[model samples]
Target: MSARFEELDWQPTDLGEISLRRRRDPSSGADVYEVKLDDDFLMSSLFTEGEVALARLGLAAASGDPLDVVVGGLGLGWTAEAAFQDPRVRSLLVVEALEPVIGWHERGLVPASARLVPDTRCRLVHGDFFALAEDPRGFDPDSAHRRFHAVLLDIDHSPRHVLRPGNAALYEPAGLRRLARHLHPGGVFALWSDDPPDERFLSALGEVFQDAEAHTVRFDNPVLGGTSANTVYTARTPQP
Candidate 1:
């Protein structure tokens, strides 16, 4: 059996102290990997249904084949892994603010890291996602103003509850409009939220894109002995 608890990596970043830890789950008898920013629990391998669903639902809304995708967070690599499962995805650009998190993947410290690091289709970029979204140059560094078929985001806790106060702007109408410019017509944008669906946020999305809807992804929580839910908000650019 693996050690009861092991902290694989820790780094102090501008965001805060970020750490990656692995622990044995007594109930499942499996090792669980977790990422934390300071005292806030960011992601746990045990509860990744929402993250996977974010990619699945977002890509499902996309209309074309050979999709190019941009994922805004690289926590544990679940979202990017899930996106790669779709054969239609030709390329994946994952924008992460913390360089340490990218190093974790490159060093193969996380479960999905081994698969993600060797894949030529995946490119992990160290940059601020929100800042990139607002930039006219967009997510791709080499290709300016590049557009993607889908953008799956799991960075903040929710539209209202953000890790950084500056991130809150991305949820606003003006911010959403800025992000939309980086999408091709009929492209999709999906976001994962720890909180329940927020109608006000949905309204803001409606202003920026067509067919904006919120999906509640629920999963069993052994620790709570009940079900827990997270929200995935999906929106698509207007088709010509």
Candidate 2:
């Protein structure tokens, strides 16, 4: 019953109040962890195929070996952890806007916390993804102008549906151009969308990168019945 649910953690963020909770997922009849931004659900441990796909698809599409990666959001740590599955991934940098979300991982409060904290190849950077992308200094403040072989993002729900107003620019032309500057030649950019592939967004990516495609990741949605799907949009930078 819902009465058995527990709020694991809660903190106020610049975007909103973020909360982590453990509750019964009626569809699966199991307890699942959930992350919420104020009243809106941000991520759930119940469905993570798409999140994992973001890292897998991106790294696979990249052109080089011993890849360096940057993940835009650290939502339950699924995407970041997934990146490590590839032996080619030499290093991983996760940039999260909310400090509380990072704290959840550091304190071993999230599902993927154990894997992330002990992984020497993985590092968590507390900063705004959008700002870091736009900055000439790149994602890491100490290491300026660093470029990665793959950049995977799972922040906003979609290009049109953003978590915050400033995030909207990230999907625009200028923003995309700035982001591209942070990638190695023929590097990969992958994004996870809760919605199906947006043709317009795909077209925009096509214009910015060399090859672009939207891969559909489907999974059983016990609560909704039948099945549900998310989109992983991947593109590669131009080769030098």
Q: Which stretches of candidate 1 lie over 4 Å from their true place?
A: none
Model 1 / residue 163 / CA error / Å: 0.7
lDDT of 1 by residue, 1-240 (tens): 889999999999998999999999988889999988899888899998999999999999998899999999998999999998899999999999999999999898998998898999999999999999999999999899999999999999999999899999999999999999999999999999999999999999999999999999999998788999999999999988
Off by over 4 Å in 2: 1-3, 26-29
**TM-score, every prediction:** 0.99, 0.96
Against the reference, the lDDT scores of all candidates come to 0.95, 0.90
List RMSD in Å for every model shown. Answer: 0.7, 1.8
User: Which candidate leads the pack in lDDT?
Assistant: 1
Which pairs, if any, clash in model 1? none
lDDT of 2 at 123: 92
Q: Residue 50, candidate 1: how far off, in angstroms?
A: 0.3
